[model samples]
Target: MLTQIQASFAVNALTVSMAGITTDLDTPATSVGTAITAGTFAMAAFILLGAKVGSRFGTRGVFQIAVAIHGLAMLGVALSVSPAMLFIAQASSGAVIALIAPALTVFIATNYHGAQQARAIGFLAAAIPAAGVLALILAGWFATTIGWRWSFVLMVALAGVNLVLSFLVKKVPAQPGLSIDWTGAIIAAVAVILLSFGFSGLATWGIWLATPQAPFDVLGISPAPLLVILGLVVGQVFFSWLRRRGREGKPRIFDLRVLATGSERAVTACMATMLFVGTAANFLIPLYIQVVQGRSSIETSFSIIPYTLSIFLASTFVAYLYGRFTPRLLATTGFIVVAAALTLLAFTVRGEWSQGFVVAGLILLGLGQGSIVALVFNTLLSAAPKQLAGDVGAWRGLVHNLSGSVGIAVASAFAVGMLSSMLLAGAQEHPEISDELIAQVNFNEANFLTNEQLAAVLESRASGPELDAAIAVNAEARLRALQISLLGLGAISLLAIVPATRMPGRREGDLPEKLEPDDDDVIDPVDEKETVA
Candidate 1:
C-alpha cells in the first residue's frame, strides 16, 4: 500500500501544481500538459520491458531500486527552473514507475489468494484515490503558501517511506529462462511514443490543417493526425511481431495469453474507457480552477476534495460487493451515473466559479468513478490465471498509462482548439478593437490568461475602449470554450455505455473457464477462499 500510494502521489501531486509551474516557467498550460503526457508516454513505452525485467531479476529488488530512483526524480522536479527541466525530470520519474508497476502486482499475487487477494487488491486500488486526496491537500497548501516546488518535497518524503517499507516484503525467486524480446519491445515503444506525441501536439500542430509549429505537412494537411494513424498501424505490427515470436517458441515480453479470453478483453476495454474519463477529469478540473478561475493550487485542491474522497471511499467499499453484483451491471450503472454528472456539469459551469453546481456534479462523478475503478481491476485479476499475474500487470500499466496519456492529450487539444476558435470569433464580433491590437496579441496562439494578466497586457498595449473590448471578448471566449469542452466530456461518458454492455453477463464470482493448462493453476470458483497456485 505504501509503494502504491507513493507512486500515485508522485503523479497526481504534479497535477495540482501545474498552474504554478507554468506561471513560474513562463510557459503555457498546454506545455505542462505535454510534460504530464510525456511522463505517461514513457511509462507506456517501457512498462512491458519492466515487467519482463522483474521476472528475470527479482520483483522486490527491482521495485526498491525503482522507488529510490523515483525519489531522486522528485527531488529533481522540486528544483526545476525551466519547463524542459521539469519535463525531463517527470520522464525519469515515469520510467522508474514503469519498473515498479508490474512488480507490485506480482507481489500481491504471490503473497495472497482468493478472499485475501480480493481485499489486498482493493487496498492497492484504493490507495490511488486515497493518496490523491492527501497529495492534493498537501500540494495545494504548499503551492499556495510556500512554493509549488515544495510540493515535490512531499513526493520525495513518500518515496522514502515506501523505500523503507520495501524491506519488509518477502523476496520472490527470479523466474528462469525469461529473455527480453528486444525487437518487439523496441517496436512497441516506438508505437506508443508516436501515438502519445502525435495526440499531444494535435492543437499546437493543428488537428487536420497544418500549423506553423508542425514539423511537416502531409499533402498540406497536418502531420499530427497522420502520425496518430501511423502509430496505430505500427501498433498492429508490434502485436504481429509478438505473435510470430510466440509461434517460434521464443520467450515473449509477456504472455499474451492473459488477454486471450473474451471477458479479459472486455475488462481491458472497460478499464481504458473508465480511465479516459477519470484521467480527463483530473486534468480538466484542476485546469478549470487554476487557469480559468485564476485561483491558487490550494483552491483547486479544496474544490476537488469532495470528488477525491468519494472515489477513495467507493473504491474501498466496492471490492466486497464482487459476490453480490455482476461486473457488467456495476460497470454499466457506473457509466450512466458518470454520464449524468457530466451532463449536469456541462450546463452548470458559468463565467464565474459556481462552486455549488460544480461540486454537486463532481460528487456524482466520484461515486461512479470510484466504484468502477476498483471493480474493473478486481474483475480483471479474478478472470486471469495466477501465473499470468505479471502479464496482467504489464497490460494494466499499458492500458492505464496509455489511456491516461491520450485522455490528457485529447482534452488539452480540444480545449485549446475551441479557445482559439472562440477567441477569434469573439474578436470578430467586437470590431471596435483595432486590427493592430489583434495582430499584437495574436489571438490564435494566445495563452490563456486570468483577468489580472489580461489587464496587465492591456495596460502595456492599449488604453480605454480597446482594452475593455479585449477583456470582454477574452472572458466570453474562455467561458464558452469551457462549456463546450464539458459537453464533449459528457458525450464521451455516454459512449462508454456501449463497451460496458459488452462485458460478460456472468456473476462476478463465477469463473468462465480454466485460465491455464495445468489444473493446479486453475482457481476454484466454488470455494472462493482457496489459493489457486
Candidate 2:
C-alpha cells in the first residue's frame, strides 16, 4: 500500500508545482506539459518489460532497486535548474515506477488470499486519491512557500521510507528459465510511445487538420491522428507476436493467459474509462482556476479537495461491500453517478465560479470514481491466478497511463478547437476591427488572459468599443469551451457503462483461483464456485 501511494504521489506532485516551475525556469507551459507527458509515456511504454523483469529476477530485489532509483530521481528533480533537467528527472521517476508497480501488485497477490487480497487491492486503489489529496495540500504549500523544487524533496523523503519498508515484504521465487523477447518489447514500447506523443501533440498540433504548430504534415493532413492510427496498427502487430510466442511456448513480455476472458478485457476497459475521466477533470480544473481565475496553486488545490476526499473515503468504504454485491452492480451504479455529476457540472459552469455547484458536482464524481476504481481493480486482480499478478499489474499500468495521456490530450484539443471557433465567429461579428490586430492577439489559439493584459494589448492601437468587444468575446468563448468539454466528458462516462455491464455478475469473493500457467482451461466463475464448494 505504501508503495502504491509513493507512485501516485510522484505522479501528482507536479500538479500544484506547474506554475512555480514555469516561472522559475522562464519557460512556457508546454515545457511543463512535456515533462508530465514524458513521464507518463515512459511508464506506459516500459511497464510490460518491468513485469517480465520482476518475474525473471526476484520481485523483492527489483523492488528495492526501483525505489532507490526513484529516490535518486526525486533528488535530481529537487536540484533541477532548468526545464530540461526537470523533464529528465520526471522521466527517470517514471521508469522506476514501471518496476515498482508490478512488484507491488505481485507482492499483494502472493501474500494475501480471498477477502484479504480484496481488501489490500481496495487499499491500493484508495491510495491514489488519498495521495492526490496529500499532494495538493503538501505540494501546494511547498510550491507556494519555499519553491516547487522542495515538493520533489518531499517525494525523496517518501521514497526513502518506502525503500526501507520494501525489505519487510514477502519474497517470491523468481522464474529461472524465462528469456525476454527483445523484439516484442521494442515493438510494444514504440507503439505506446507513438500513441502517447500523438495524443500529447493534438492540442498544439491539430486534431483532424494541420495547424501552424505541427512539426511536419503528411501531404496536408495533421500527423497527430496519423501517428495514433499507425500506433494502433503497430499495437496489433505486437499482440500478434505475443500470440505466436504463447503458442510456441516461448517467453513474452506480457502473460497472455491473464487476458483470456472477456471479463478481464471488460475490467481493463472500465479502468481506462475511469482514469480518462479523472485525469481530464484534474487537468482542466486547475487550468481554469490558475489561468482563467488567476488564482494561486493553493487555491486550486483547495478547490479540488472535496473531489479527492470523496474518492478516498468512498474507495475505503466500498471495499467492504465487494463480498455482498456483484462488481457489475457496483460499477454500473458508479458510472451512472459519474455521468450525472458531469452533466450537472456542465450545466453549472459560468464566468463566475459557482463554488457550491462545482463542489457538489466534484463530490459526486469522487463517490463514483472511488467505487469504480476499487471494485474493478479488485475484480481484475482476483480474476487472475496468483503467479500472474505481475502481468495484471502491467495491464493496469498500461491502461491507466495511456488513458491519462489520451484524456488530457483529447480535452486540450477539444477545448482549443472550440475556443478557436468561437473566437473566429466573434471576430467576424466585429468587422470594424482590423485583421492586423486580430493577428497580433493570436486569437486563433485563444489563450486565457486577464482583463488588464487584454487592455494593455489593445491600448496602443485601438480604444473603447473594439477593446470591450474583444474582451467580452474572449471571456465568453473561454467559458463556453470549458462547458462544452465537460459535457463531452459526460458523454464519455455514459459510454463507459457499456463495458461496465460486461463485468461478471458474481461477487469477487467467490472467484478466487490458484491455477498454474500450464492450466489450459479458463477459470469459469460457475466452475470456480463449485470447486470452492
Candidate 3:
C-alpha cells in the first residue's frame, strides 16, 4: 500500500507540474489549453477503462499494467518535441494514473481492518503533497537551471522506480462472471471528450458573462455557447441510455445505484469539493508569485514550501484524528479554514507584506484541504462493498480528476479574464502610453522580462513624465488582476462548504467502539488468503 501510494503521489505531482512547465516552455494561453483539455480527456478515459480492467484482471494486474504504461508515458514526455506529442504523453500518463489510483485505495480497504484502513488511506493522502513538495522543489530548480525538459526526464526516473515496485505487488483474484461493457465505455468516452472539449473552448473563447461583447457564435454563429449546449445534451442522452440499459439488466459502464448510498454520495461530494479548491489554489498561486510578487520560479517554489509542508503535516495528523473525531467536524473545519484563508488573503493583496499573508493563507488552505482529502478517501473505502471495491475506487478517482480539471479550467479562465480587464482598463487610463509598449508587457513572463523591454517602454514615454507614475500604474494593474483572481477562488471555495458538511463524521479512534468485533472476527480472511497465495 505504501509503495503504491508513493508511486501514485509521484505521478500526481508530475501531472500537476505540467502546468508550470507549460508556462516555462510556452505561452500561458497555450499551456492552459493543452493542460486542461488533454488532461481532462485522459483522466476521464482512464477512470472508465480502469474500472473495467480491474474487475476483469484484478487490482494487482491493473497496478502492474498501469506502472508499465506510466513509465513509457514519462519517457515519451521527456523526449516530446511538440505540444501535440506532450499532450499525448500526458494523456497516457493520465490513463495509467486512473488505473492505479482506485486499485491502490481498494487494496488498502481489502487488506486492512477498519481503523487501520483509515490510517492507511490517510497516509496515502499525505503522500500527495509530500510528493508534490519534492516535485515542485525539483521542477523549479531544474527548470530554472537545466531547462523544463530535464524535469520530464526526472519523472522518467520516478516512473522507473514505480515499475520496479510493481513486481512486489501481490496478485488479486478477479471477481467471477464480470465482463466489460464496451458500449457503455464508448458512450462514456464520447460524452467525456465532448464535455471537456466544450469547456476548453469556453475557457479559450471566454464565457458569455466574461466576454459579453463577444456574442454567441458557432463558426460565426456563437460556437462557444452552442458547443456547451451540445455537450450537455450528449451527456444527458448518454446517461439516460445507460439508465435504460441498467433497467434492462444489461451491462453499464457506471452503476448509478451504487451512488445512492449516503456515505458514497457524501464522500464523492467531499472529494470533488476538496479537489476543486485545492487545484484552483495550485493553479493560481504560482502565477501570483511570479507576476505580482516578481519572484523567480525557484523563489516561488520555495515560497510554497510552507504550504506543502502544512498539507503533509495535516494529512499525517488526519490518520490519528479519523477514529477519534467524526469526518463531518474535520471536513467542515477544513472548509472553514480554507475559506478564511482566502478571505484573509483578499485583504493583503496590495500590501508590501502580502507575501507573508499569502504564505499564511496557503498554509491554512493546505491544512484544511489535506484533512478533507484523507477523510474522503477513508470514508469512501469504508462505505463501499468489498466486492465492488475496485469499481467504487474508480468512481471516486473519476470525481477527483474531473474536479481537478474543472478547477484548473475555471481558475485559468477567471485569471485570464481578470488580467485582460485590468490591462485594458490600465491602457485606457494611460492613453499617453504606446500600444506597442502595452503589448510588450508579457504577463506570463513578468518575472523574466528583459531590462531592455522596460527601458524601451520608458524611453517612449512623454518627456519629463514621472517614471514612478508609470511603474505604479503597471504594478497596480497587475496586483488588481491577482486580487480579482483570488476573489474568484474564494467564491469557489465557499461552494465547497455545504458539500463538506454532508461528509460522515466517523473517526478512526471511534471505529473500534462503533464496529464491535467478535473473537472470530479478529482474524481477517484476506490476510490468511494472502499468506497462502
| Tens digits of lDDT, candidate 3, 51-94 | 76787777787787777777677677667666777778777777
lDDT of each: 0.79, 0.81, 0.65
Decoy 2 TM-score against native: 0.90
- Is 1 or 2 the stronger prediction by lDDT? 2
In model 1, state the lDDT of residue 38. Answer: 71
Clashing pairs in 1: none
| Candidate 2 wrong stretches, greater than 4 Å | 22-29, 81-84, 352-354, 427-444, 457-461, 514-533
Give model 3's TM-score versus the native structure. 0.79
Between prediction 2 and prediction 3, the one with superior lDDT is: 2
Error of 2 at 52 (Å): 0.9
lDDT for model 1, please.
0.79
Task: Tell me the TM-score of model 1.
Answer: 0.84
> Which residues of candidate 1, in runs, are more than 4 Å off?
14-38, 75-89, 142-157, 215-221, 351-355, 420-473, 507-533
Q: How many backbone clashes does candidate 3 have?
A: 16
- Poorest stretch of ten by lDDT in candidate 2: 510-519
TM-score of each model, in listed order: 0.84, 0.90, 0.79
